[model samples]
Target: MNLIKQYVKEYKNTYIQSVLLAVLGVVSGLAAYIVLAKMIVGLIGKNTEFGFYLQYGLMVLAAMVLKEIFAAASTSISHQATFYSLKKIRQEISKKLFRMPLGNVMNISSGKLKNIIVDQVDSMETILAHIIPEMTANIIGPILLLIYMFILDWRLAIVSLIPLVIGMFCMKSVMASYGKKYQQSVEINQKMNNAVVEYIGGIEVIKMFNQSETSYQKYSEAVHENAAFYYHWMKETMIGVSAYRKISPMSLLTILPLGVYFYLNGSLTIVTFITIIVLSFGTVENILTATNYMDDLSRIGTITKEIGLILDAPDLEHGKENVSLSGSDIELKNVDFSYSEDKKVLEGVSLTIGENQVTAFVGPSGGGKSTITKLIAGFWNADAGEVIIGGKNIKEIPLEQLSETISYVSQDNYLFDMSVRENIRIGKPSASDKEVEEMAKLSGCDEFIRGLSAGYDTIVGEGGGHLSGGEKQRISIARAMLKNAPIVILDEATSYMDT
Candidate 1:
């Protein structure tokens, strides 16, 4: 709720204006009810003057029109503010992810992050754009109507509220364990999402290893678990929910019976009785409309809290200074690092590579060869020692400057879904088309790229899925070659390339 408040504050002017318009709309609706009641009273009293009836009829029509116009305007303004706020929230999350530690980013599965960014963020739109202004209008309108009813006849007004109290009790019972149930639903949904993503992403692997049936079983089990959780939760709450729905709309039962009793006792006038009945219906209707959004409102707090966690995640410490590098000489001084508390990847490691020298670290798998390169590339800070580049501790260099000083091509380089030219240009965004082609030629990919249907402009599918393994590797190499950084670290970069 606080996170929602903060975002609403960002667009306070629009939010305020929308709420004011909604209030105006509700007022218009109440005015229409009043006009209708006046017309009905006149008709019942045998005052069938054509002009009087026509005048009241015109007023009711005008009030109804104004109500619709104001309601539409409020909805339009609220949607604009809601979408813009969501956009800002998404952008903040994206920037936060960029600054966070790579390890932290990797720890969260892609499907879960997608759920937060796409599904969860999108869910807030309905609550923010529609529920906020509309629900406020619904609640306030009923209160105003109830106050007018009390002024008409306080005794009957209290009678009219009996159903509302009962409805509220039912609602409270329904929501007693709503938070826990909703939390369970969210957890189960995320598990299903993760399993679905993993299943689809590993479909090829499953087929190759003849484990498709087992993988499918896992995915189907997750799906069933999610469905069963929701079914049971809804089953548990159905009784209370049904009671609320039945009770909230039954205002007329109390109003009609009590109003007749008062009229029979000579304590209530026909006009006042009619007015109370008309207005009571509107009050109950407004309350019912408001209660319709309770589920959305309840979930708002949970969704925003999840998004806030991402936005408030801690970022790795970085320096702002961009120092000049004398040369590409790299050094590690008694460095120690561990990916986790229980496992040490590198310990008391000290080494130096001279400028213009070719050095290879030959070791068994898991011997920290990749870790050493990542440290030099500033992917992660060493836990116990400093990694020096050109006489300056790597941590002291600004990220942008450090990136410009190194070109790291890993064994599994990812390619964007774009034309070859555009993908290559990512290495040097300002490079001309000619410069990109030259780099592609240098990386031995230009000949194959030229033979494609659109040549350099050919659309490479996601992760270069349309290209062969060797071709994708060459394109990645071309991109890295375009960077032209002072130091190039190739971690099995040519593994996919042909002999």
Candidate 2:
């Protein structure tokens, strides 16, 4: 709950307004119960006045109307605040991702990241929009009613509290293992999501190699595990949950019998007895409604922890001051790097490529060829030693400035679901259409692109799925060429294209 508040402090005034409205709503509802009690007491006393009936009847109607209006207004205001807070949280996550090292970002599963950002963050809407004001009203309304009952007759008030205490005990028993169970569910959900994403993303390969059976088996297994976990968890907790639901709202169990005995003994009046019964039920109703949100409240910690994993991650070390470069030459001195601790991709490696000279590292597969290029591209920071470009350590250069000075095209380049022209324009967002076509011509993609149905206006589809591998490679080349950076590193950038 504190985690949610930290992100929503900017909207405190709006939330307060909502809470005030919610309180008014609860008071209106309680006012209706009071009016009912008055009418019932009047009838019991044989007051046959039509005006008395009409006046109390009208008051009850007015109370109901106000309750609905205040509730609707409060809900609308709360939803607005919740949406704005969610937007702010997502924006912060985006900024954090941009600041983090590409390697760190990649280390996290894409499926898990998506789940946290899209699903887990979205789940907070219930707590923010409904629980905040509603819970406040639920607690306040019941507490106020209980106080009134005490003033009327303290014995009945204590009797009304019996069910609440027992209900809480049952609820506590259910919640004992809730956190662990919910965490397990989250892990299983992530695994299922990952399997589904992988299956969809690799459908082409699966079909071509006739591996559908095995791939489907994995996907189905993950889904089954997710379902089975929830089923067993619910089965285990059903007894306690059922007990709470049945016992919590049954305040009448004690109130009715006790009120009868007190009234029969002449210690309590009929009017007080009936009024306490009515108000006790109302109090129990409010308390039960409030407790209904316990499940959502309990999961706040898990959800926040998932989101914090990304927001709290350590970012790559880089200087903000832009340094002047001596030249365009690149050098790696005593550099050591590894994707994992067990296997060193590059160890104490030194190399230099002079400015205005074409250079390439010839090596077998898995020999850190792409890794070296990526280090120069600032995709990952070296575990040890320094990578220098233009006689300055890369870390000394601002990430944005370093990016602007280098154009890197990897073998597996991704294109957004946008037009081919717009895809190339990503290299230089402000590039003119003519300049884009010029780069396409220079990269030998112009002829083929023009042959397509919509020419350069054609949508590339996700990751250029609409085009062949070779075509996508040429378009990527055009995109990088459009940047016209001083340093260009092509790590098998043309692997798909013919020589």
Candidate 3:
């Protein structure tokens, strides 16, 4: 339901068209089948409808032809709708990640977030395009067919329905119990993602501290847990599928015997009985199709909840009027902050930073220096008091405008997996190649970058793996410098460099 609501919001303009096309396609396909049944039964019967058979045959053929075309059109429209919806949904999620407070986004790691951004969003397209529409078509096609069968013969209608009922019960049991195991699977996957990211990011540290064994153990355990959860889920699913296969067949076999009994007792006609038997195959399929939709509902619901939690996270501060702080000094007055409500990191601590001056935050670890820096940079809001710039409260200033005033260089500089030139271009997007090279030189990155074989055209590895820590830092500083901001707040930017 969450996925559906979000999907509707994302593609509201196309919602009606997609739904209408699906309904039209399903109805036309079923109508084509009905027309054929009527035309065939009409001929060589007590009605003796052979005279108009050719005309009706042509009509049926046209309807059949229309069904194919309409189904294709509907499927195509549905694909487009799903594509657009997923695209917008991913963008919305990215926007939320940008605004969400620290705790919200940090609850999941970069690797998991990467998977969610890339793979999970794509998973929704499968749910929407194939699973959702096919499930709907499967259901609508079966119900209409059953209605037609009932109109022909009620007794066989009842006979054809038994296995469907039982299969549905199987579906309910299978899906309801699935939530626990699937949730476990997700947890294990998240843990594995975190472990892999941590291990890879600190490979040097692991070697330095002789912690490879410990990290490997953690990695193996997380991966093993994920594998075990998937194995369990598959084992359970196999059981259900085997049972469904075993029981769903009973429809045809049971329908024949019971239908014969009804016929022997003069309760049913031969033509009606044959038609019901022919359509009994459709019953088991309808149940299966409904179950498939249930499957999509389950997966989509999980991801939707995850995304919703992120979007609904509490903001650091309620955003207000847009104002730009141009080349202004920063002041923190009577500010207090706490990660936990009860314990304060900064209690009534105040500081001032002059514009264009290199101010260093020097204190022992956990002395709130980093916290103060983050607060001044507006990554977090103070619990009390104000961070003012250019005589305006930081919260009152539009983030982009405040951002325009200050250049930040944080530890663990993240570089996009693009060319060295392209990564630097993020700060001053309009910079010419010559300007980029000049900026790189100013930051001392030009020498190393030019030494690389690919130089500016090189595709950096993920998270800038191609560069060493010093190289990445210089590049980051150069990028920030290219912005030409009046103020720069660098938190632990030189930490990677030995003091």
Candidate 4:
């Protein structure tokens, strides 16, 4: 909740206004109940004047109309503030991703990240836009109404709270281990999400290998496990939930019987007793609405903690200042790295590549060829030793400067869903159309690109899916080539290209 406050603090004034309006709406609703009691008391007292009935009836209508107007305004304002805060949170997460180590970010499941960024952050909308303002009104309104009831008759006021107290016990039981249970729900849901993503992403391979049944079974099992967990969880909590819902709003049960007893004993006046009955109904309605949000409120900790894992992650260390390079030579001194503790991918490895040289690291599959290039490109820091570029340790160079100094093309290069011109221009954002065309020709992408439906302006679908593997590789090459960096590292970059 404190973390969420930090994000929403910028819109504090707007939220305050929303809360104030919501409170006014609650007050108006209470006013309607008071007006109804007054009318009933007048009719019972033998005041059968038509003008009096019409006056109180119009007042009740006006009160209800004002309540709706204030509620609408409050909701509108809160939603605006909430959406702004959500935008800021997402933007911060995006910056956090950029600053984090590539390896660390890649290690996280894509489905989990999507769930946090898209789904989990979206969940905050209810808490911010509706819960905060309206819940505050619900609570404060009941408190204010209770004060009025106590003033009318202290005995009935206390009696009115009996149902509420019992309802609270039921509510407490349901919320006892809510945090732990909600976390388990999140984990189970993530497994289903991951399974669905993997199944769809590998649909092509599944068809090619005739493994649809096996893959589908895995996906189906994950979904069933998630459903089963929720069903059992609801089964366990339903009794407590039902008891709270049934008992909480039954304030009339206690108020009616006790008020009548007091009235029969001449301890309570008829008008006061009747008024207390009407106000009890209003107070109970407000309390029940507020209590209904407890489940959403309880889940806040888990939601924020999930998002916090990404926002609070340590970024990769790099020097802030750019450095002057003596030359383009690269060197690694006794470097080592491993994706996990149990496996050592690179150990005591040393290498040097001279300037203006076409160096090739020839090795069998899984020999750390791609890992070695990634280290030079600053994708991950070497576990044990220093990587040097141009007579300077790579750590001394700022990330921006290091990025500008290297041009890397990997086996699985990604392309945005945009035109060929825009995708190639990403290598050099300010590159003119002619320069892009020239780079395409230099990288051997010109002939095929010109033959496309829209030439260089052709739209490349997501991940360049519209292009063949060979065409995708050539376009990637053109992008890297446009950077015109001193260092170029190609790790199976041409694997998809024609022989």
Candidate 5:
């Protein structure tokens, strides 16, 4: 909720106006109901002629239509608010993920984080779009209904409300039981999302190892759990609906008869008894339905809180003054780092990369060599000591300028589903077709690219699946070459070549 609050603060005025308009629209709509009832009573009393009534009825109909128009306008306004908030949120999360320390980001699932930033924001459309306006109507409509009910027969109005109160109490009990389910379900969804992403990522390995059965079971289990949760959720929803349906209609049945019995004994009038009968349904059902609306609200609250956990996390702190790294020379002094507080991966290890020269880190595996490169790129911050580059601390450098200063090409070269030339453009997005080709040749991809039917324009499969190890490596190097930064860090850059 704090994340949402911060994200939406800029759009608060527009949101307030939309909600106000919605409230007015709902008021106008409920007015039509109350007016129609009064008009009917006038006819029943023979106080107004049919012609006069018809004219007034038409005016009420027109007003109701206008109310609906206001409602539509309110909806459009709310949609804009929701869409803008979502857009800002996605952008913010993207920036935050980019800015956050790489070591910290690595501890969480990328798929789950992706879901939080993208899918979760989209899901919140329900809260900002429908829930707010409906809740306003529900709360306001009931208060008005109760006020009118009081004017009719205070005693019976109070008496007949027992069923509604009972229904509410029962609902509260059910809510208490299931409230935790919302959070539980969210966790399961994140896990399932992570599994699916992992499955897709390692599909090549799975096939190579003949692990079809194992892969299938993983996929099936995630799907099955999601389905089971939904099934139970739907069952619970039905029970709530059924319980209300069973309980609320009886408010009228209970109230009207008792009111009539009073009228028959001369304590009430026929008109008052009739009014109670006609008006009883909305009083009970509207509020009862309002309770359903609350349940939706509670569920949305859960989602917002889940989303909050990520967006509200302490951002990778940056000094107010921008830091600059002047030379390609790299130095880590007494730099200690860890993903967790106690489990340090690089413990007081210091290293240096001489300017404009390749500094290869060789170790069997898991020796924290790649971690060193990540730290150089400001993808992460050292828990202790500074990462000095060109005699300037890298931490003081502005992120955009840092990219202009350093490039890291990891072993697993990543390529977009784009033309051979386009993949190299990431190093310098504005590079011309000629510059891209030149860089590709320099990185040793020119031969393979020229042999392709489409050459530089050939579309690689996702992650460059169409390209072999050496080709992918060259393209990655081409990207680095295009970057032309003063510092280049490579992690297993030539590890899996076909040689």
Candidate 6:
């Protein structure tokens, strides 16, 4: 609720306006109910004038129109606020991801992050846009209408509340383990999503190894588990849910019998009795409508908690100081680091490479060669000691300065789904078309790119899927070359390239 309130606070004025309009709409609806009840009474008494009855009918029509207009206005405002808030949240999440440690970000699976950023965030739309304003109106409108009923006849108002209390008692049973149940359901769904994404991502590997059956079996198992969880949860709660649904709307059961008793015994006038009955019916109907949204309301806490986790993820330490570099000399002094607690990759390592010199680290795989380069480029900080460039500890350098000084291209370079020209221009966003072509030719990819149907303008599929491995490598090389940073770290950068 605090999470939701924080977002609502961002668009406070618009949100308040939406709630106010919704209240007005509810008032208009209740006014129409009152006019209709009076018209019914006038017809029954046989002492009302024809013009008076016609005036009441017209007033009812006017009230109905006002209700719709205000309701639409409220919906429109709330939706605008909700969508904007979602956009802001997504942007913040994106920015936060960049600041967070790469290890921390990777700790969460792609499927889970996708669910949080896209699906879970999207689910809040209905609650914010419709449920918040509409449910508030529905609940408050009934309380106000019930107060009017009490003024008409206090005893009948008290009688009208019996069904509501019974319905709430049943609803409490459904709500008892609702949070736990909902959390379990969400976990199962996330696992299913993860399996689906993993299967699709590894489809080529599965097909190549003929492991489709085993892989598909895992996916099927996940789907079945999710389905079974929901099935059992719903089965368990069905009785309580059904009881609430059946009992909440039966307002007239208590009202009809008790109002008749009061009237027959000369304790209640016919006009007042009929008015109480009609108004009480409207009150319970509003409450029932509001009750229908309880499931969505209950899930808000869980959803916001998930989103909060991402927004609050720990970030890597970054400094504000910007240093001027005289040369691209790189040094590592007593650096010790590990990817995990027990597995130390590098320990007490010391090395130095002079400016304008090429150095190679030749060793067997998993021997900290890539790790050494990544530390120097500030991809990850060493656990102890310092990696220095230009005589200053890399930790003290601003991220922007570090990025500008070093161009690190890894083996698995990612390419966006965009034109060949646009992909290369990512290294230097302001590079002109001629400059892009120059870099592509320098990296030896220009001939192949020209052979394609659209040359540099051709759209590279996701991760350069449409291009060959060597072509992708050349494009990556071209992008790095375009960056023109003083220091370049090529970790297995030439593994896919042909001589």
- TM-scores for every candidate against the unseen true structure: 0.95, 0.95, 0.88, 0.94, 0.90, 0.95
Candidate 3 runs further than 4 Å off:
9-13, 24-68, 265-267, 318-320, 324-327, 497-499
lDDT of 2 at 181: 84
lDDT of all the models against the reference?
A: 0.88, 0.90, 0.75, 0.92, 0.77, 0.89
Assess candidate 2 and give its TM-score to the true structure.
0.95
**Candidate 2 worst ten-residue window by lDDT:** 1-10
Extract clashing residue pairs from model 6.
Answer: none
- In model 6, which runs have C-alpha deviations exceeding 4 angstroms? 47-50, 321-323
Residue 492 displacement (Å), model 1: 1.7
For model 3, what is the C-alpha lDDT against the true structure?
A: 0.75
Q: Against the correct fold, how does model 1 do in TM-score?
A: 0.95
Cα deviation of 392, candidate 4, in Å: 3.7
Taking the tens digit of each residue's C-alpha lDDT, what string does model 2 give over 287-364?
888888888888888999999998889877777998999989999999999988999999999998999899988989
TM-score of 6: 0.95
Best model per lDDT:
4
lDDT by residue (tens digit), candidate 6, 1-499 = 6767888998989988999999999989999889989988998888568898889989999999999999999999999999999998899999888767666787888878988999889989988998988999998898899888988999989888888899899989789788888878778888999999999989999999999999999999999999899899889889998888888777789888988988999999999988887887778777888888888888888898889888877766667878777688999999999999999999999999998779999999999999999889887888998999988888788878888998888888788999999999989999999999999999999999999989989999988889888889889999999999999889898898877
Q: In model 2, which regions exceed 4 Å deviation?
A: none
RMSD of each: 1.9, 1.9, 3.4, 2.0, 2.8, 1.8
- Report how far off residue 59 is in candidate 4 (Å): 2.6
